[model samples]
Target chain A: MAVDEGLKIELGKQGVFVTTIEELYNWGRRSSIWPMQFGLACCAIEMIATTMARYDLARFGAEVFRPSPRQADLMIISGTVTKKMAPQVVRLYNQMAEPRYVIAMGACAISGGPFKQGYNVLKGIDRYIPVDVHIPGCPPRPEALLQAFMTLQKKIDGQPLTGPDRPRFLDAEAQGEFPVPVQGEHDLEPTSNPGVWTVPVVIR
Target chain B: MASSPYFSLAVLFVAALGFGLTPLGLAWLWGRVFSPAKPNAVKNAIYECGLESRGDAWMQFRSAYYLYAIIFLIFDVEAVFLLPFAVAFTGLGAAACVAMLVFVLMLIEGLAWAWAKGVLTWA
Candidate 1:
């Protein structure tokens, strides 16, 4: 009936196709991931450089960096997270539409790097948000970021589209929104945490 | 009614809504069901360059940019009106030609006025 079909018959091949929806879904998800363009410190510069022509992140289909969290699929925490800025970071993450990802792009974002001891610096962004990939470096080189993208793509390929254990965004009811941190006199604290400013509620 | 020609508009309107919402809804559904939800105090907080914001983010901005936009709008309107006239020039009469010339001259006069008033200058 068709040229390819005739060749297939001549080769003695059966054309029965077999695949689950999850595999297809995962394939699509792994291809195009839009990352949030916002960045914090020195690592942000490297992140921008990765998207430029030299490194060319567009080849991996992740070059489109969205300014708005609602449109972004990935959040590359590109710098140190401070106590005051922690709440803001979480807020941005929460604002992002589902099927989102997070990649800690540098030593500062991973564990505060050299600034870990600083009074204002957060020890690690993982303390605030769930990081999917951690790219370890003072400011991870563009090449390293490319490697991280490959790793993340591999992880995305393993995900299932539908099942008893589907993505949190698809579950809807199980979807958790991070609580906005309240700015305290000395430091920032989660409002949901016990006894932020006042005394803890005591039951006699 | 479905028989009406305006029915196409209704279909388009509904299709537009579906087009915009489907991708967003699908993405949200996928993320919520599959992605892990491990939010804490720090995770939920706002991000501001890894530091505590000292004051309110609101600040006064200069309104001088509006003058430039107004000037651009004037030229934009001129082009919009002139583009059709330019394409239809061979079919136009002398009266129409004179009318367009007068219209263009008025805009040039306005430009001259703006130049005289120093609106063209950045200072």
Candidate 2:
């Protein structure tokens, strides 16, 4: 028994515990997220407001606003993305490392809000890049953002790699109305396609 | 019988250099004390306004720009020299005032030459 205990101690001294120690460290790092200090439009103001004294996002261990994308793990797509700006946003998303998560923070990001009819705005950000979570509101209240953070925490715990029904929105699928992609200038313009069915044909 | 203009300028230059270095030196010392130990790879990078840096730092600018910039700097220095003299002209008496008038005429001649060269036109 004394010899067995001595052998265990020797193995521990030889860096046998390094992997276990690193795993524990990684877990702690992932749990307390340091969001990147990035914002596109109006929703970004609300995101900043969340960090202020009133809402105090620091309580959730996510107050560190890293300016560098390489150092950050979470990206909050907080506003309407125009077609010109879409590619830049996609490039920024791709620059972030894998196991990174995104929080689509507004009705604009989730479904382009009122700008869906506009030619410049993207119908939805998800069309450009994969979204892990969607927080549906014109500009969600800070408390709603706090709730979304809790939802994301639940997602991290669940660890689902790929699935259609991963994130549960408040009004899932935008109050039963599916988002239609704006194809071009003519597509958004008022058309008299009386024969065309209202039922959306999901493009494969 | 009196101190030279060159002697007064030397004193101003030394005082200006001392004032400029004070803030720079304090910032350097403060950074050394509080900054984290820069791991070898991450520390040496040249950050170009947040974007990743690429290519050589030895960038070449157009010669047209250099010519225009030199002209601007010469005029700027002339203004700096003339402002203080203008403020003190009342006390300087006749001989010093006449010397400054000659300097102004020379500056005007230089400006006319530049204008004739078409460098004064907004490109």
Candidate 3:
């Protein structure tokens, strides 16, 4: 009986600890999230800030900034997209493979912000390529960007890719102006479940 | 006139090792005690600064960056060769100076090739 017990323990040492599909998938997803560093203007600074000391984006498992678009799974549009830059932006969007997400990180990207009236600006980025989330603010605070990321997390968890709407963005026809009501701004104030969504905006 | 080289080298090596080790060791110990649990579906989702991760992160990259990296490598190699001359300048005199000049001329040729190929153009 003792010999059998010893054999069992030895077998345990060699056995694969994660045998289930859920566990394996979770492992792959949590590990290596490559982000493309495509900064066009001002909001790019805030994106850099997210990866810096106070924010430390590495903690969230997305600090790897891949210069190549093919390797990245997330693209943060951090500034204005001018007519000159539009074709380049569309080309970039096409280069990325399926199952990717775009974060429009400022009013400029969300709806061209103050530059909406300019003939050079593309208005909202959704006009060119789909936007998964529109983060408001002249430049949304880094914490707000973090909140946007969490909302993305929730969407990934709950939603299914049934058809066209499954992707994290609104359809071009459904696209709207800046500061589309999505959620509250990030607050350092003490709260029960700090990251929970308070206000909900439905974009049809 | 300079102090013994051996002592100075030893002190420099020890200080460099200490600087690299302390933070690495501290982070290791801290992780052992307080590592967060591995994330699941909910926790592992992509962050959007605080918004949802939308669309795709992948994009087309310009080919100019590769050309720039190649140029950087050429200059980097030139710098390596120049270092030896810098160290032995007083002893090597005019012959070494002329050789370095020749080497720099070769490097400039490579730059000219890149320019002719139009790799230097932003577009």
Candidate 4:
């Protein structure tokens, strides 16, 4: 059962903490989001800066950047997702443990940015894997990365632990593996994952 | 049994074990109930560095490398021990000197064995 905010505040005033299982679960999950340590391009420099002293991301409890996808809770796709690199990126995302989140940092990752017309660049990473937050900019400042991280934390906090609206990881029926795209004769075979992304219809 | 000297130690030991095991038990129970296992080929793969791992991790090495290992012990390990022994030589007792001598002799004997076996000869 959900506790009334007013009642919870009153309990806190009386030195007693009031919480539900969902709140406690979400709080713990959102607090310790360890991002995978791989970086794509120039935007990766900003990602590194976000974890460094001045913009210290540890304040949000996401400082630990795990080298292995197995230990990571978040994947910060910081930079351009070239067609050549896209397969490896999707594979890394697929290897990540359940309850993982992705932050498509910078315009390059969200869209191909300046390289949109280029033959090699992948339009966006979200075409293959789902993204939780998108931070726009050629290479967004450390502040932008920090903001995206907070947005992800908010998203995590609001997720229901049970019932129909619960997050994908909690749902046993949810798709387990995001298919790792392969390098075909021309471009990435299958283009995009049908499960996560659909062809954006053009207006006449 | 309550009045026995070891009774308190038993209680403390139980408490220490409970301290460690309680959280582990709770985590296992929580995982079973909330997070269902969703293992797949990609997620269960041995290598985590994105690239597909090729071939078996089990590979054979040459048995002749044992001679190099012995030689390394004689040269590298001997220098490490000898430096400390030399530095403290002035304050060492006759017994300590004898111990150092025995250690040096054992390393020399290994070198001698390797030399006699033609390990020092470059093919």
Candidate 5:
């Protein structure tokens, strides 16, 4: 019933489709990427606008946003990740089922934006979890996020599961978990630093 | 014993339930088979808006709400009793009228007592 305009004449004899196993697999995975229904700060407003009637993120088949991290495969770090919230963010990232992705949406999520020198702000979410796409803006417009989605889809299409040098998420269950940060005197630390964790016992 | 009409109803109910549950079951199966689920300590921890939860949630609640709930119950029960009286009003005799009058008077008395006690005022 439906056909591509350019390919109409080319497939006049036989409209039968053909594709390799990997292509089919990649297409299925990239199409229905369910992002987490999570937000941190102001940039979240723009993220929400992208899903509304005007932008209609559902057109690309990625409208389902799961509240639970276990259900979501895409994480959009929409705003600045504060030091106090680092542990919980890492924890959330670890819970996401593979093949999972992280999109550092907006400059705040990418590198703390204008709050780069703030005492409470984490430099970037990448300090803990690996990022897939980085969209740079103090608070990127809805169009920018849509562009990020396109870029991420393209990235997903390139990954193959059969090769030796395959991406980490190629084997759905092979993703390494990021260490949850621990509270330190000045800021949260990923490692069990003796300077932070070990209490100096008072001796007589 | 099973009959044709009841059997038809059972079949319809079963079809409805199946329609509702099939999609949910398939989704769960697909997620279980295709999605990887490996949880650790931090990943499994309760979410509290991206921060660790503070002190115990339970604390002593204010007693003023108790009076409000009790007042609501009195009026709610009064409406339940009044329903039968209103339904049988045209068929009732003088004796029933007297009894209904007494019942309304008692309710009015209770309301007056609560009003006198300043229970109606917001503290």
Candidate 6:
């Protein structure tokens, strides 16, 4: 159960911390969101800049970009998700430990950007893996990436530890592995992950 | 038992173990209650780096690399001994000189044997 905000504030003023298990759990999870070190294209440079001194993503406790999916808590899709690279990306996402989050950090990653018409581009990484945040830009500035990160943290903080609305990692029955697409004779065997995404039917 | 000196040592040992184990036990319990493990083929795969791993890690290396091992030992051991011998050369007695000569000759003999075996010739 959530503690009353006013009561919590009063307790804090009196030097006593009042927090529920959910609050403490969410606090810990939101604080240390280590992004995977994998990068695809130009937006990766902006992602790198965000971690550097000027933008200082370290302030949010997300400076540690783990090279392995096993250690990473977040995956920043920082560029165009080409069809050629989509399989590997989905495989990496599948391999990541539970409570994983994805940030589609550019126009390219979110919706293929200028390469949308190109046959080589995957259109969006969310086609294969669920994206937690979508930052709209050809290549989003470091500040935009930081904003998306804070938005993700807020999303994490609001997630209930228990109940039907609890995040996928907390849900035992939720699908764990997103299928990795294979290169077919023409294109990827499967265009999108049906579990996470479905082709939107435009109503005329 | 309270008067025994070993009792305090036993207490400290138990405290030390508790200090290390308490958090571990708590974490395990927390996982069991809250985070249900979600293991699948992709997540449990042997290779972690995106692409599926191709070959066996148990593949054999070329046996011809042993020649380089012998060559390395000859130079490495000679350098190690020769540096100290050279540094203390003027202060050494004739017996020490003879001993050093024998050591150098032994290494030289190994090199000569390697040369006779054509081990130095790069294929």
Q: Which has the greatest TM-score?
A: 6
Regions more than 4 Å wrong, model 6:
A202-204, B66-123
Tell me the spans in candidate 5 whose CA falls farther than 4 Å from its real position: A1-13, A171-175, A191-204, B1-37, B44-68, B71-123
C-alpha lDDT of residue A52 in model 1:
96
Please give the range of 10 consecutive residues that has the lowest summed lDDT in model 6 chain B: B64-73
TM-score chain B for all models. Answer: 0.46, 0.51, 0.40, 0.56, 0.48, 0.80
DockQ score of each predicted structure, in the order shown: 0.11, 0.03, 0.02, 0.61, 0.26, 0.70
Off by over 4 Å in 3: A1-27, A161-204, B1-123
Model 4 score (lDDT): 0.93
Q: Model 4 reaches what TM-score against the true structure?
A: 0.82
TM-score ranking, best first = 6, 4, 5, 1, 2, 3
* Alpha carbon lDDT of each predicted model: 0.79, 0.66, 0.65, 0.93, 0.81, 0.93
The TM-score obtained by chain A of candidate 1 when compared with the true chain A = 0.82
Write model 1 residue lDDT over A1-204, tens digit each, in one string: 123655556555566544456766777777889999888999999999999999999999999998877678999999988786777787888777667899998998888899989998977777666788999999899999999999999988876556766666656466466556768887776533332123347999
Local accuracy of candidate 2 as per-residue lDDT tens digits, A91-124: 5554553345688899999778988888777666
lDDT of 2 by residue, B15-48 (tens): 9998999979975774464222322222233451
| Cand. 3: chain B TM-score | 0.40
Taking chain A of model 5 alone, its TM-score versus the true chain A equals 0.85
Q: What's the C-alpha lDDT at position B92 in model 5?
A: 98
A1-204 in candidate 6: lDDT tens per residue? 667899989999999998888988889989999999999999999999999999999999999999999999999998988999999999999999989999998999988999999999998998899999999998899999999989999999999988999999989999888999999998997988899899999999
Q: What TM-score, computed on C-alpha atoms, does each candidate reach? A: 0.59, 0.53, 0.48, 0.82, 0.67, 0.83
The segments of candidate 2 whose C-alpha lies over 4 angstroms from its true place after superposition are: A1-27, A30-32, A52-61, A157-204, B1-60, B74-112
Tens digit per residue, CA lDDT, model 1, B1-123? 999999999999999999999999997885565655555443343642333456666887789877676678668989999999999999999999999999998888878877887998886
Clashing pairs in 6: none
* Candidate 4 lDDT, B9-98, residue by residue in tens: 999999999999999999899889888788899888888888889988898989989888999999999999999999999999999999
